[model samples]
Target: MKSNLVCRNRETVRINEYIHMPKQLSPAQVEQFWNDGFLFPVDAFDGVQAKKYRNLLEEAERDHPGEIHAEHRNNAHYILKFLDEIAHHPVILDVMEDLLGPDVLLTGTVLFIKEPQTPAFVSWHQDSTYTGIEPKEGITVWVALSEASSESGCMQMIPESHHQGILEHHDRFGENNILTRGQTIEGIEKERAVDVTLKPGQISLHHVRTVHSSTPNRSDDRRIGLALQSFIAASVKQTLGEDYALSVRGQDPFQHFLRARRPQSDYEPEGIAFREAANQRLSDILYHGSELKRDY
Candidate 1:
């Protein structure tokens, strides 16, 4: 279908207050997201813009090679500062509203770089465990800047896994599921794993509680993705003095940021509240962990 959203020379689109999707999501797709807690192939960024962002990331890596983690040699650099330009992007806001409703807050931003030949594997787990958010209804939009496929270590998810509620998790490098409060859940069928492959610019939106993971890059091309997680304000509750903490750019270290959504029908309240809550929560949890300390 032709997009009414016009692009400026294929690199960027001029998004104003009137942003809307050329095609509204079908009722089935909406139900799928609600029931399964994930959505795939939602247009957030286009090819040209993805290329531009990729170049920016490459430059960041080149200038700051030291910033690249040793264990993640295949992994490079990332940043997540506020960008009014992105906030106004039509496709982004459109999908944000569709999934999160009108009241969506920006919780956290991450730029994941998997260099070629990197053997780092992200174990299966739920994202809400790390965010420390209550309700755990947040949405994480993963935007692929390059062609991501199973051969190149794309993401994998368990179908309808979120329906199982929070599962038991272990720390990637530690003994207990540092963020899971030492709790564990049984009954995950490993045979149901599904790999996600996508072309450059394609995006996937999943719930914070969804069981997901990614393999190391075995492909020659680098695998890069920008992850933006959003939530509704009402779903976020403060959790301070907890064993686990959520770290952000400028805030003191604290444990967990809850993901929440405004009542589904109240769009305006949801959007405004989410925006404010995310800013505070992200600023608090953005950079908790230090640089990578392993050799993949």
Candidate 2:
């Protein structure tokens, strides 16, 4: 489970027999991964760092409120500007590079903030479906900025569900639920569900195709998390379809969006198109969200 991989030039790369310090995974952990398609307790951020990011998120929320888009809200793309000082400290880079290999590109980021008494709940589905990529090579690092537990609607997954590949998604209704648009899947059990609860700063890593979801926050405390999805260095490609805001350092904002194949045939093409358009529209609405921050 130990890796001799070494990072070079800010890009992660593998070196054989180099014995360079790298994150080590145990045989049992690897086997569990092979069976469950996910890993947990890899490394967690410190409280100070978590609080720093939490404050930043609060500020953003105060400024933008409901104006932020799905992609741009919570400063997802601009994390590096404050990541070192906030969360995802250098300690995480080792495990990330170990799992994703060198030459990594952060493809997606999300902040799951479950406020007290909110009925929001994420539907069961694989992460790869939303990512515009192929071959399903990516890692989702879910860092708990606050305490996460089943009572507060922690994440749950079906062990070894990734091996089943893409499963049909069904429409689910609730407070915050997945509108699967009336799709169904066969050969899967609803009885097998594992809730993943972590203390503040703890993290969980899962394969892109792993089936996962979370329930609403019914507890009094808010459950906040920052998720960063990283892929191998070779996964970068110019977006060919819709337009999205990208925050590459020292470059113009990324306005081009790419469209990749849907993981399930039941995925609604019209819904996808509407989501893309809505994202663009939201970006326009919050165009000044980042402009107000002179230091970000």
TM-scores, in order shown?
0.65, 0.67
Local accuracy of candidate 1 as per-residue lDDT tens digits, 129-178:
64555556667777788988897888888877766556766434533222
Error of 1 at 160 (Å): 1.3
Residues 1-296, candidate 2: write the lDDT tens digits: 01111112113322411335445555455445545767877655677767776676676566755433333433343323343233235555556555544445454456677788788777777775534455554567788878889888888877877765566654332325522221223444657978888877788878777787888898999898777654323444433233333322222233233322221221245434543454454334323222321110
Cα deviation of 127, candidate 1, in Å: 0.4
Off by over 4 Å in 1: 1-24, 65-88, 174-187, 233-235, 241-296
TM-score, cand. 2 vs. native: 0.67
* Per-prediction backbone clash count: 25, 4
Error of 1 at 40 (Å): 1.2
* Candidate 1 lDDT for residue 45: 68
Q: RMSD in Å for candidate 2, one decimal?
A: 11.0
